[model samples]
Target: MADEDNPDSGGTVIGYERELADITGAIDRYGTGAPSHIAIVAEPMAGRTTLVAEIRRIYGDRVNYLPLEFVIMDSTVLDCSTYEGDIILIDNCQFLSTRKIGGFDVLDMFLRTQITSKKLFITTWNIHSWQYLCSVMNLDAYFPTIVTLNRMDMPVLKQVILSRYKPGEIRFLDEGVAERSMFFSVIHSTMRLPFTSAEISVPWIKLNFTLMLRKLPRKKRVQISLEDVILEKINRIAYGNPGVALMLWDESLKDNAISLSAITETPFSISLDTNESFILSVILSMESLHAKDLAAIAGSEMDIDRVIYRLVQQRLVRDNAGYYSIEPFALGPVTDYLRKTRRLW
Candidate 1:
């Protein structure tokens, strides 16, 4: 059976079986003459584009693909109305609006078009942006079929990362650390007092395969391989985001060989002011943004250059030419800080 006929029949699902099913099921509903617009929502680098690509691959020319790379204008949206396809596919729908006063104008326009148009619209969104929009504009009511992606489990993430490779293509090497039980790690953090700043050193314990394997019976523990241990570490650090796990997988793969110690964490303490935190929040939602547009959303009070410099120096955000984004490995930590400080919606 075809993917449109059955979502599970699709290739390289990236563990999005449920989301793909929701989307294709909506498409099936459209075949019955009742159009159900779809929204694919996920965190940045969490496979939003991958999902859109899978849809296009399955549906072929029946889908019209329009991916927004930056903040869009009213004219761009005017052009969007002209695409005549059974399924209109869009990626990075977060770019349809900005976070400023007049920023949501284009999004509002697009939503209106979606409400009145007869064509089935299948759109992708950054999860943070969707949440913010939901809070402010009640965005959920617009799309009856909402496909939201979340973190995968260790087994699912392993399948996703290995799907790209042929069987036994990559070798997992044992480094003899499997027998060791406990390890000590130290990280530096800062606390800002009313008058002075101070650094604090903290020691923490990390659970490798030792703690987990110990819970199992002796026979089961003996059955686990270095491969299982390596993948588990990757999933733990990635926090179940397949994209980040794959990135870590690629980084750990050296000359087609991987070891337990090779997959490590990217450690950096994140401390930001109100303005800096807000900018980071914007980058998290938009995924990537140019300095000019970031300035527009950040407004006139902020010195965009300095903020960018600080974020870059701290390794929280990366500046590619001018398109700034949260560092792939830093996504989890950055998000936690933003949410804890209430900078993100």
Candidate 2:
């Protein structure tokens, strides 16, 4: 679907109408007598900052925004007893704690202050960190209104990308090659014999070839535009994160043109042992960490060098100076794998 109505508009919040409305409604209710506290949870580069910006744009003076950067500031900033605004917006709440023991003291203090204060608090959290906190401390119980962002669907994803460019400004190239392919596979299994003198299990040896073919296109002209198809692929690779999708678009665009083949997808079948997965989870939660810090988090039982070497060999991570981080394109797949295995929490 083409977003012709708002073709010239860029940087507008897309696919978050319901979430915006819920947040605004909470603030409005707070103004009248209801006590409201909200928690906006999303993955990194999943548009938490964008949604907060939109809130600031709408509320203007009524909102007092406090962006927390824990790398520089510590728990002392959580002493919000002096804040005067009726509605307080805190971004990056994940910075309140670390992986070390007793690191959640800041979060505990903040929760205590929030419960006593009359002001409505709206906070944003990194999804992975939030999951960990939820599992460890039952953090979600404190926020009466929690809004978790869902991944964008294809139509909304198309609208978001198209809104960034003018009509026909970016060329969508098609190589004319097949959009998909087919393959065949063979399988072997064990079976039980039923008609024998006595029922027995035996190895089933048979020539079994299964053919899987890609769905062919309809005889009629395609309904979706080439740009839409490219955007769809980009969104798929990005796992529906708008910011990641935009980054992919920039990386794939060449000479003001983008092709279906230009957008690459990270291999989803990457295998990682438990130690590597734990180390990756730590790195992802912290963005980048030194080897010593990683080792500290991974504990002495783990051989950090071997795990790091394996991760580096797989191209899932990169080392900068003495720090390591997930590769840019690999973030989506790595995060998905960690989440699937329940290691991110």
Candidate 3:
């Protein structure tokens, strides 16, 4: 495959490029002198992991990736003096937020260790948690560098999709299949600015684009690139959630052409009338509650366990500290409905 044909090669590296450059510079500055830690703050789905992967690609074995997701240790585990490395990449530091053990504390401890030792620390966080910590705990002093992942524009999104298609990956679409206007429409709608997190958003964009292209009819189909259609839909409905968008597009592929109606009818589609109502109710009852609390709230009227599980799947709510709460953006409608109809007060 030509270098550009590889999506990873020509993908949306723009946003993180400068940040990574800065990190590399920081590492070079401190790699031999002293330990330095950098914190990367982005919205969920904004593309943190990909950026990290890119960093690893650039740094190779010199960087030690300590993904926080799999680490079951608490706040104090960060304090353990046994850890020693030249570079530390800690992804998903926001997980510490829910533990009431903010990433700041963990990062603080880690940085303290790095200062005396010889290691570079880099961490990623969900933007929401970053702001919350900044406000509640004055977390700004912890990191000298904070990189926020910006969403891709039309051109970048187009490049990202087209780059994924090898001449042989699909025998369908014509060359230069993505149209500018259409591409703009799709990316603008699908890719959100100041993303909730790149870790959540990038995979979503990549997956949705691929799934959408595959669904195109081989011949006598829409002349438009499957990339365009998927991007458009992703722009329209998916926004911060590429996962849901991809899954919905997969459903549309059953018939080879997806319509808004088909999208609404998909089983995973969040039905405003039915599912949204239940989610709103549960969220209103428990502000910042965990998954089980959501189950408990809905348990009296509906299948609490099932509802909480589905809510998590829908991304309408999330589990923090074994508790569940509605996503920040989703809180308004849920709160309004609860006040008016459910009498949540």
Candidate of highest lDDT? 1
Task: Show where candidate 3 strays beyond 4 Å.
Answer: 1-15, 32-36, 70-73, 79-84, 99-117, 167-230, 240-315, 318-345
Clashes of 2: 0
RMSD of each: 9.2, 11.1, 9.9
Q: State the lDDT of candidate 2 residue by residue for 39-100, as single tens digits.
A: 99877776787788887777777678898753323567766667776778998887777777
Error of 2 at 58 (Å): 1.7
Sum up the clashes in candidate 1.
0
Instruction: Give the clash count for each candidate.
Output: 0, 0, 25
Q: Which stretches of candidate 1 lie above 4 Å from their native place?
A: 1-10, 31-34, 76-81, 176-221
How high is the CA lDDT of each candidate model?
0.77, 0.72, 0.52
- In order of TM-score, best first, we have 1, 2, 3
> By summed lDDT, which 10 consecutive residues of candidate 3 come out lowest?
171-180
The C-alpha stretches of model 2 lying farther than 4 A from their native spots are 1-12, 32-34, 71-73, 176-224, 288-295, 303-313, 319-324
Clashing pairs in 2: none
Model 1 per-residue lDDT tens digits across residues 140-227: 8898877777766666777777766789988999864533332221212223335522212232334345546656887777455567
Q: Which scores better on TM-score, 2 or 3?
A: 2
